[model samples]
Target: MRKMHVWDENNLIDISEVDRNKVINPMLVFSIKRDGTKKCRLVARGDQQDLSTYSKDRQQDTINNMALMTVLAVALDHNLIIKQLDISSAYLYADLKEEIYIRAPPHIKQKDKVLRLNKSLYGLKQSGANWQKTIKDYLKGKCELEEMRFWPCVFTKGKFLEIIVCLFVDDIVIAGNNVNTINQFITDLQNRFDTRIVNDGSPNERDAVRYDILGIDVEYKKGVSMKFGMLESLTKKLPLLGVEFKKESRYNIVPGTPNRSLNQDLDIPCDKDYNAKVNWIQRAIGLSNYVAMKYRFDIAYYTNILAQHQLYPSDAVLFETERLLQYLWTTRGKRLVWKRNEKETSELIGLTDASHAKGLKYKSQAGYFCIWNGKKLFARSTRTSYVCESSTQSETYAASECLAISRSINYLLSTLTGKKPDQILLTDNTALINSIKGTKTINLDPDIMI
Candidate 1:
């Protein structure tokens, strides 16, 4: 905060301090890394933002997951070192454009004086957008890094060897072919912002510590691979759903069964306890969906099914939620392994499928999973809102959704790889494929179009 001039106590405004400027108590959250390392950090309780109105566009700053995956794939292909860097008090690094005030922290001796913020502070809605703009300006204007066209959060610089930097809010992951280039980038970051180079231990060392970023614990093996997992996090998270796995419990080999009754369109009678367990069921599905989205794609389809019934959950959904927890417990040890394959190709493959009118409301369920050079890039499944007249239309709708996601992924890969690789989309419906190629005609009903 001192480095950024976040506040000036002496600066006073004529207006009286309002309740909107009130601050909440900060707390510390602790977690264990996948490598059995302990981590802890203090975070402000920023939930008081409803007190003020935010009209600014706040979604355009960060890079998407597909962009991050592209950089990771590029790094893996080039045998480059990937290092994570953190900006200290990232929000405070930018000056606030609006004249805002925040209550002084409890530890300060001056209790009555309100802090007139000179820079952005935590709990302010605009802080993230402001800090992101600040970082972008510094990198592009001062450091001379060129931002990618589609992925604004990704920057590239070249001295002797090209260095690629991917940003996720305040956390940065950098990879380059030359060690000196990587070091110089870090030095530049440190010169501009108070930065900490995390997980700096020698990759070849067995005792080297891994780092945690966005709920995934990442470990790099110098020349071989990068392994990531949410094992330690899931260990602590699943118990909150009232799920406790015993050694005697039978483990399922797959995430969900082929004839998974959870996804079947069955109108199970809502028992008296359904309303009571509604919150618990929603919480479980939310936690499971997070795990699925970030770390495990295997459970994506299963979790999506659970999320559809969140508003009106039944006994069966609750039962399936428990089953999902058991599945998580069984596969907690599984990690997303990105290994160095000499023959690895920059291949973009998309697999999409849909269950026609399988939903209780007769809506088709659609899902797609994508991969880049054997690494899972993105996956999503959803029950379509529109009711389809035929199976081909359902498949077409599913394929279109998959195509949208794949386009973004392809754009990222094209920018990073400098060559747009062929995006091969696989689907089980031959008529849908033929319809896409204009070789077959399929009628689109008015309801389907809607």
Candidate 2:
């Protein structure tokens, strides 16, 4: 805080001068990194402040997972150098909009005085928005980068330099064909804000770029493929969740069995230990959902099922959760590999499927995956909002949802690249395909058509 001059120490005043409600208590948070490094941050109890005082546009946008993956595929196709960076004290660089007061920290030796903030601080409701605006202005104005219309967190430099920069809060991933241009951009960023490269080794010594972002480990192969996985993270978390491996001859080939009915209603145990069990089940489901979303699409369906029962999970649900974790542990080496596909033409390819009336409430389960350059860009497994009367109707509903998401992905691709690529959606249901081809008539809800 002293280095950034986050606040003026001389401006401290008595509490009577400021509204007591506006004054927030300061908090210090500390954590240990994987490398055994300790870090601390001073934050404010922003929750105590009046909600009406916050700006309606305080929520900041980050690059979506689909767009991030698409960019990585493009980078792999072009053999672009991928590097990562972290902005030191990122939120502290932004100027605070609202008038806020904080009680002095214990080490400051001024217990009676309240300090006025000049810049954004951690834990503030609008801190993210303020930091986003700060970085966006610097990139657009100082760095001369153009922000993508569809993805505000993505920026590119055209004409002379072919570079792309993606922002996920404080972390930055830069991809470009020109090494000198990328280095120069990094230099400019460092000059503007205190920053450090997140790449594992020194640039000269680094053979292949490797780093972790958003809990996903990313590695760039020279001309092969970009590999993404969560093995290391999952390995560390499994023991904490009580997932154990025993000497067994056989292991689960799949995350869950298709024949097993995960949606069956089971009585929740009324024992005193039920709450603790429920919490453990929820935690396991949460971790599984993260892994499924980022790296493993195979577990997506089962993880979604476990998530639905998180509120009141039965012993059977807990057992299912453990099985999913065991499957993950058994196949921890599996990763999503984005290989360079020479014949890949389209920017986005979609495949969708539906399970008719699979849930206890008679709701259909819909799942869809979007692909780029023959690699999976993103996938989603969700239950439909309304129950469908037939399998065809459920399939049609799933297709509609997939089409909506594909349009957004298409728009993002078009904005990034000058030309929009053709989209092809595959479905197994013949009736739905025939309806689209005008060969057969199938009654679909007007809302679904829209």
TM-score, cand. 2: 0.91
Alpha-carbon runs more than 4 Å astray in model 1: 11-56, 109-112, 159-161, 206-211, 256-276, 438-450
lDDT of 2 by residue, 1-450 (tens): 887888888788898888887788999999986547899989988878777547766699998887788788777776677888999899999998688889988988997799988888898899999999999999999889998886768889974227889999998988777777788889999899989988722333445667687888887776677789888887788779887764352546777766577566566668898889888988898888888878799899999887878766775677778888888888877889888866646556779999999875889899999886688988889888999999998998888888888778777766656657677778899888778766436443222222
lDDT of each: 0.71, 0.80
Candidate 2 local lDDT, residue 192? 90
Model 1 Cα lDDT, one tens digit per residue, 174-290: 877778777877898899888997756455458333767667777766556767788878888888777767555554555554555554434545677766677888888888888
TM agreement with the true structure for every prediction: 0.84, 0.91
Model 2 misplaced stretches (Cα beyond 4 Å)? 200-207, 247-251, 266-270, 439-450
In terms of lDDT, the best-performing candidate is: 2
